[model samples]
Target: MQGLDEQPVQAHNIDGFVFLYSEAQQKRYLSSRKNLLGHERVLEQAMESGYRTLLPLQFGLVIHDWESVREQLTVPKENDLKQLFAKLEGYREVSVKVLWDQSSELEQLMQENAALQAERDRLEGKNLSMDQIVKIGQAIERAIAARKQAIIGAIQETLNPLAIEVIENDPLGEDMIYNTAYLIPWDTEPHFSEQVEALDRQFDSRLRIRYNHLTAPFNFAQLS
Candidate 1:
């Protein structure tokens, strides 16, 4: 493990637990995006160090010394931390993102809905006013949202039984149909992945499904 300036990360044993840390001036690592990469690197290394369970600190924590580390972070929160660790044992976090071809979906919607087909027909080969175009666009947006929600619900239902917990995040763009995180027992990860693969094959033409192979349970951490 290495620090922001490439200094080796060292471990300090305090009150029966080991804290992995590196020597650095507190101000140097605060509020700087570049330094955040270094902070994440140290955490990533620690998380991959074969520990069965961990409680990760939020980024930008600026404990000045080992004494401060113990008194401020570990000592007071020891019991709660232990509980969190126990609860998180044997589980891991993974995320799935689903993207659809918007044009293809919209075309299907238009084909299925007579009202939408009529609206499109009304605009065909016409010098339509901006208001008319805007109204039609809004109607299409509503239809897309409704269809997207239904698909998300269906997918979640298919995957929920395999997970210990499910978290839904807002979709980022028009192409994104669903964004979600799942917490599952470590042993079930392979099976969870197989289900995701089946979903990919199920939506082979219209959607793309992706899942993270390694993650730190950031979503579950908040709950714990």
Candidate 2:
């Protein structure tokens, strides 16, 4: 297999388990996006090579030798590894990110709340103090946060049934309503996708849902 440096990655069998690896400087893995993607490609290739079940190491892990790898997989821990493989068998992850138009949502909020409208009217065309502006900004921030929580809750309620496990990742920015990864059986993907499509249609004007399907179960398979 070709790895981060496009060098040969050899496979070693240790107690009935296979470890595919390539020798490289640790700094290479930390260098750039290209190396990161290349590392991920190596893992994807390993899984695609008729070994459907895989537990990925933490990114940038540099085990110096075969003995280190062997020691990491030995004895009682080996049973745990096998159980993890069995648990993840026939499963993949689907990642979904929901983004909302902030300006649009704020406009809707402004139209809906009479008190907020009155507050805005009070401050309009006035030479305001910095304290007054800061308070107004804080109120707007709170309003945005509350709306995001409600929408995200509704999304999770709709999609949770189809997934074996749902992981809520930290939202990246102000416009992101939620970022989540779902662990699901391969057979259930069609139904899961249909639900996502239905949601997209439901919120088409205000929100955009980004759905990525059939990805490796990285979120679910974190190892120390």
Residue lDDT tens for model 1, 1-224: 78767878888788877877776654645657878777766766666787646666677665656788688767887887777777789888889999999889989999889989897898989998999989898999999889888878778878998888899898888788788998889878888888888887876777887788567767877633
Q: For candidate 2, what is the lDDT?
A: 0.82
**What lDDT would candidate 1 get against the real structure?**
0.80
- Using all chains and alpha carbons, the TM-scores for the candidates as numbered come to 0.81, 0.85
**Over the stretch 90-171, how does candidate 2's per-residue lDDT look in tens digits?**
9878899999888899999999878887898899999999999999889988987898888887788889988889999998
lDDT of 2 at 165: 93
Our model 2 lands, by Cα RMSD against the true structure, at 2.6
* Maximum-TM-score candidate: 2
